[model samples]
Target: MAYSERLAERIRKALTHLPIKEKKMFGSLAFMVNGKMCLTAGPERMMCRIDPDLHEREVKRHGCNTVIMGGREYKGYIHIQEENLKSEKDFDHWVRLALEFNEKLTSS
Candidate 1:
């Protein structure tokens, strides 16, 4: 298994309690909750989910780049750096965002 696979597995284990599913996408794995992408990992170094309404702000705040695929920038999704995942608190922050988005999306 590649590093990404290991990383994905770790993330999967961490999020097992959440109502989410993992799928292969962009040569990596994407975590979806309620049919919307909440997290992604692969060639990209990080994983994060952004609010579509505040994507730009979030991106700038994190100093991260937008995920662009097939000539389109995937709004509301930000790539997280592996270095940022060193701490459980940091990882949990992103997870919280994903969960919040999932809950908001499902409630509507």
Candidate 2:
């Protein structure tokens, strides 16, 4: 399944307040804010960068599972289900978390 263009557009609009840059990466679209990768949308999946310090908290809060690719679990990233993204509020929350993590890494 391919990523929905509508979903991507909605995400981009919601993130207008942030200074973010979009690029093609890993055959998908990546949103980088402040030079750190924040969010990604690929065929059938949407993921967000997780802050190492708050990984556990975020997982628990959002029920997000680690992103598994190529037979390994990629830490510091979570795959968000499409169903959860249907609501604007839900999508914003995920984007906000990604932005927060990106900010922390770039500032530190």
Candidate that would win on TM-score: 2
Clashes of each: 2, 0
Stretches of candidate 1 exceeding 4 Å from the true structure:
1-3, 61-63
Q: Put down candidate 2 lDDT per residue, 15-56, tens digits, no spaces.
A: 898888888877678888887788888665678897777676
Pick by lDDT: which candidate is best?
Answer: 2
Q: What is the lDDT of candidate 1?
A: 0.73
Indicate the worst ten consecutive residues by lDDT in candidate 1: 1-10
User: What shift in Å separates residue 52 of candidate 2 from its native position after superposition?
Assistant: 2.1
TM-score of 1: 0.79
> For candidate 1, what is the total of clashing residue pairs?
2
Pairs in steric clash, model 1: 46-80, 47-80
